[model samples]
Target: MRAFLRVAAPLLVLSAPAFGQGGPSPALIGRGRILATAADCVACHTVEGQPAFAGGKAIATPFGTIHAPNITPDRETGIGAWSDAEFLRALHDGVGRAGEQLYPAFPYVQYTRLSDADVLAIKAYLFSLPPVRRTAPANDMLFPFGYRPLLRVWKWINFTPGRFAPEPGRGGEYNRGRYLAEALGHCNECHTPRTLTQGLDMSRNLAGGIVEGWQAFNITPDPVSGIGRWSREDIVTYLSSGRLPGRAVAGGPMGEVVGHSLRFLPREDLSAIAAYLEGQKPLRNPGDTAPRSGYGRPDPDRLSFSLGGNGLPTGRGLYVAACASCHGLDGRGTASVPGRPGFPGLVGNSALGAARADNAVLAIIHGVPARGGRGESFMPAFGAASRIGNALDDAQIALVANYVRAQFGNAAGSPVDATSVRRLRLENGGRSPLVVGVWAGMALIAGLAILFAARLVRRRARGNGAERMP
Candidate 1:
């Protein structure tokens, strides 16, 4: 549900310094707009309060930061100058107009499956936008990754450029869903784990993955650790509205996906996506015993208070003062005023009941915004940077989160600590240790190669000296 769309619609990496030609019909442009929305192109290509598709947003990865390039149809700074063939090559071959290899951050590997007509239609839509004369900043990448030539090797082993083919026996609806999920949606890019070369790990596709410090939980149909219990309606409801009441609510990057992309999609497309996801092979995370939303109940004690203070308040006191107003003393939420959906109940909320407390902690720190089709649902921030009067420090936020989980979620084990809070605050989420280890191993190999060369030079020098002496 996260980690999508900056390099969407191919951004048509320009090869030559020439402007686009001819005018496209309104129908074609409209179709392109739908495709672009499906791809969530605006999320990555547009910065907040900036011209859409002007593209200076920074995408973070373990390797470094990649700024989404200017995709607005400005001849000098954007893709306005790209030819149709150049646009096609960029999307299908992961190559820039100048024949430079594009980083996988643009997602051409998945896009390579797009039909030629679909690719061109997106281009037509982009060309229709008013040209923004803006340029994207240079990428700030690590030593090895900055060298674009290395992408050739990465793509060779991991990429297979081709159009999607429908299954012979399956009906058109199933194939349509497959096309939307695999080609247009590219859900696996975030939900699926990655291989050593940072490519999608297809063997355990959609089992689960992490992005930007938040876990994009398993979408497979496993009874445990995945969405086995989520009916097709539940999936569609969550996708379209960003909440399933007592189940899950969208937060972090998932919230962005809902607000920017999925909400705008047609109901049928949402249903199709749900169908495709439900049909995926069930894969389980090792320790999960029940559904994430099945734990916790209404608190028995409604009226209780403690401050534990030497000028410091207890978690219960904080919750009572700030949280209990909207979410009741028993943790059942109240209705909102007019146009908005009111505060969500903490009990039976997936964020609280999940094995990892990352989402719950993040919600307390950053606050949730109005997203999906759910009304103007909103929460205020309580982190260090928050301007609100009720803002909490790392230690305080930890206390509140732990208290909520214990009292309502029944998730009784290791508690969320302040150190973990600080790390998440720094935007350093859980990256795969295995990937880090691989990089370290490569560095060790390079060092050994250098040592061997030095030893050989010394041995030859000594042999020549001995021969001269004799």
Candidate 2:
């Protein structure tokens, strides 16, 4: 599961009594298809290599794994039985077929802002797909989160079921962009930091947050920390194709979003999204001195990869052995045709230039997956057993991350240690110490309460027996 989906899973769990047997119009179904794509429906609803929207992907969280439910109109196990009203309620109110509260992992909090017509159109499009009879495995949520009814309290505190309202005097482009980004794309759900309860903190919208150990860098208009310097075209190109040469390249969850959703949208709609983001409030993150991609320069003379007596590779040696081919010895990318895409360069690359070395470390561990469009791009994984070569250990990854950052990123003085790499390696699903502590405390309390109740029951039984004997 993507980091964003870690907080949100089992989204669009639509079901209810079937609507009339009459089929919807072809035009409506086509329109619904586009709307669903805009909303990135298939990404969550379908498991890879499975029937689209058949939904059996296990979404992992701190609580447990949530398997995405079938939404392929299967009469027995999917949304084929769902009425239009039921579908609308699921998206807009976070309610399931039997009036059960849907988990926040579904992002109904943002989906609620979708207009009724749009919501129905998505349902129509889903119903048009071929029905698969596979039932999703049951969710394995732990303790309190598994209790669906308790979501009532979460909704009460965080949710507001309402349709999107366009700002008065705002141009069509801005309003349309806002609607797509907020209601459909749900951008802030990942980009914005979460509250203690795991709800989106609107106050820091697009200021950037970590997802799956990768930084979902700030998209706000702040000049120092965000994309304020990026032209509207840069935004469009990056969103549509997932890379911007020397500036940025989509990785991790954001990469998935581009590959699955953004590239499919028409150029005009992408432009609208860019225009809207350009006008957002500029908020600077603490300690951000310049743009993440503003540091590092190509220097061919810096290459030095000497090995020690123990045959251990130094940081530079590891990078040279693993990365020098694609990202050149000079930290510039390998050369390609004049107008064709080439390997992404290390100098001024966002991943290497961030304050924290999490993204850099993770990229080395997981490797960048191949992305389609604008020519194929990929990196080999060195984690566990390497696909291309010997697997890099945790200490090696930390060394590489630090070396890459010092040579190509904004933070030369600050380095990521092996312990941080180990944490990201073992538990990169955003489980902070505070969250673990809270869970531990709750478990302890529950155990103590159970013990107290058992002791009380034993005492009561003994007293009753004594009274009977008398």
lDDT of each: 0.79, 0.78
Which lDDT tens digits does candidate 1 get at residues 285-322?
A: 77788878888888777787766958667887788887
* Steric clash pairs (candidate 1): 15-97, 15-98
Per-candidate TM-scores read: 0.86, 0.86
| Model 1 TM-score, all chains together | 0.86
Candidate 2 residue lDDT tens string, 4-102 = 111111222123222335766665566667777778878788888889999888765555567888999889999899888899999999999989988
The TM-score that candidate 2 achieves is 0.86
Candidate 1 residue runs with Cα over 4 Å from true position? 1-22, 309-311, 372-375, 428-470
lDDT of 2: 0.78
Give the Å error, residue 149, model 1: 1.0
